[model samples]
Target: MRKLIIGITGASGACYGIRALQMLREIEDVQTHLVISPSGMRTALEEGTGLSGEDIRALADVCHHHKDIGASIASGSFRADGMLVAPCSIKTLSGIAHCYADDLMTRAADVCLKERRRVVLMVRETPLHAGHITLMDQATRSGAIIMPPVPGFYTQPKTIEDLVTQTVGRALDLFDIDHPSVRRWKKECATEA
Candidate 1:
């Protein structure tokens, strides 16, 4: 099975993390291991994901406690194909860049880097300062892919949902998922038959 580790931090846009989990669950070939920050749980509930271990379980194959550094996903020997930190907060980004594995999410990211596997940071922040930009740079220099949740409008998306799907689709593309997660505007099709 193709395994991926996903981390959700207590960032403002919980929808991104929830949507990513939902989409990952739809991939039969992908087995997901999840870790959620304590704040993430609150955000998930407040943002209407219903917030419980069961909710996390329904989204991913396995859910590890935030403090469980001893989890299988924390070891390079487990050999995951990649790690995704969806809706990653700036704090989480800083922690991961500095190798501060105080939480399972950061530790899992650290493990992926050490194992030379893909690490995608769906960093959810805007109007970033130089320090924030530097953290992203350090992570990329360490072989991690820095992906912010910035969406595009060339497609003239009819709804906000469409916008969200586009970002998720692009993220999935980085992992090279065989499935198309969202629709793209084909020039010919946009012009009609």
Candidate 2:
């Protein structure tokens, strides 16, 4: 089984985390370990993730507390296939960049790096500065994929749900997990022609 860790940080776009979890739930081969940062919890409440922590826990095959640094997911020996921090905030990004394992989320990210597992950071921020770029560069150097949640115009999405699905689908693709939300680009059908 592919053991995956999905961390929800306190980024403005809480929907991405929720959507990612929803997608992960469909993969039979994937066993997920979920951890939500304190700030993410507040964001989840503010934005209303539409599901409670318990609800999320049930969606995931395995869940871990964010503050539980002693959790098995926090150890490199646990052998996670990858870790994804969707809606990763600037603070959390910097924390991971500096190897600040103050919490289980960061610790698990650190473990992902040390263990050479794929770590995808879905950062949701704009108006970047030098510090943000530097932190991102540092994390990438340490073997983390920084995927900013910048929506594209090519798809010409008609609804917020479309945009969310595309982003979440892309994240899942990184881990080779199949999600139906994403519309894989294909040539126009004869009906459209």
Candidate 3:
């Protein structure tokens, strides 16, 4: 079984993380360990997902509290395949970039980076200033993939859910987890006029 750790932060797009869990559930071989920052839960509520913290926790195979620094996922020896921080807030990104590991979410990401595992951070901030760019650069230098939730127009997305699914699907692609929902780019064949 492939074990993946997932973190949800207080960023605006809570749906990305929730959709990730929902999609991962369809893949039987993938076991998910979820950690939600306190702000993440509040944001989820505010974003109107209608899912309480318990409801969200129920989606994961294992749920770790953000404050639980002792969680299995916080250790490099735990052997998780990798981690994904969907809707990764700037605060969380800063923590991961600096190796601050103050909470389980950042700690697990730190462990993943130290272990040379794939750590995809779906940073959700727009109108980013230079400092945010610098933090992203720092995190990349430390071996984290900074993937902003930018939707692909080529997919011809018609709904917000479509855009979210595409982004989440691409993020999962980094872990080599295939989901039927992701639409791949194809070269168009030119016909003779």
Candidate 4:
């Protein structure tokens, strides 16, 4: 089984994380372990996922408390394929870059880095400053992929859902997890019959 660790932080784009979990649940062989920060839960409510944090937790195969630094995922021996922090907050990004494992999400990411496993952070910040740039640089040096969810309009998305799913799909692609929602760029658009 492929083990995937998903972290959700307090960011505006909670929908990305929610949609990712919904897609992951459809795959039979993937075992998803989830950890959500308290602020993340609040953002889910504020952003109106229409699903409570508990409801979201139900989507995962296993859910860990944000404060549980002793969780299995915090250790390098947990044997996960990779970690993804979708809609990652800048605060969480800074913490992960600095190896500040004050919470399970950061701790798990740190472990992934130490284990040489892929750690993709879908950072959800805009109008970034020099400090954010430095943190991203530091994180990249530490083996983290900083993926901001920038939309590709070339996909000809007609709805906001299209954009969100496309971003989430691309994030899953980083881990090589196949999602049906992605609309890959083609050399030419298919013509009507």
- Write model 2 residue lDDT over 124-182, tens digit each, in one string: 78889999999999999999999998777678899987898898888888888878667
Mind giving the per-residue lDDT tens digits that candidate 1 earns over 53-154? 576657888889989989998888897989988889999999888988887899999999988899999988888999999999988888889888888888
**Lowest summed-lDDT stretch of 10 residues in model 1?**
184-193
What RMSD does model 1 have? 2.9
Best candidate, TM-score: 3
Q: Model 4: which residue pairs collide?
A: none
**TM-score between model 3 and native:** 0.97
Clashing pairs in 1: none
Superposed on all Cα atoms, the candidates' RMSDs to the truth, in angstroms, are 2.9, 2.8, 1.1, 2.8
RMSD (Cα, Å) of candidate 2?
Answer: 2.8
Worst 10 residues of 3 by lDDT: 68-77
- Model 4, range 26-51, lDDT digits (tens) per residue? 98889999999999999989987899
Per-residue alpha-carbon lDDT of candidate 3 for residues 1-193, written as tens digits (9 for 90 to 100)? 9999989999999899999999999999999999998899999999999899899999999999889998899887899999999999999999999999988999999999999999999999889999999999999999999999988999999999999999999999999999999999999998999
Q: In terms of lDDT, which candidate is strongest? A: 3
Of the candidates numbered 1 and 3, which has the greater lDDT value? 3
Native-to-model Cα distance after best TM-score fit, residue 102 in candidate 2, in Å? 1.1
lDDT for model 4 comes to 0.92
Judged by whole-model lDDT over C-alpha atoms, candidate 2 comes out at: 0.86
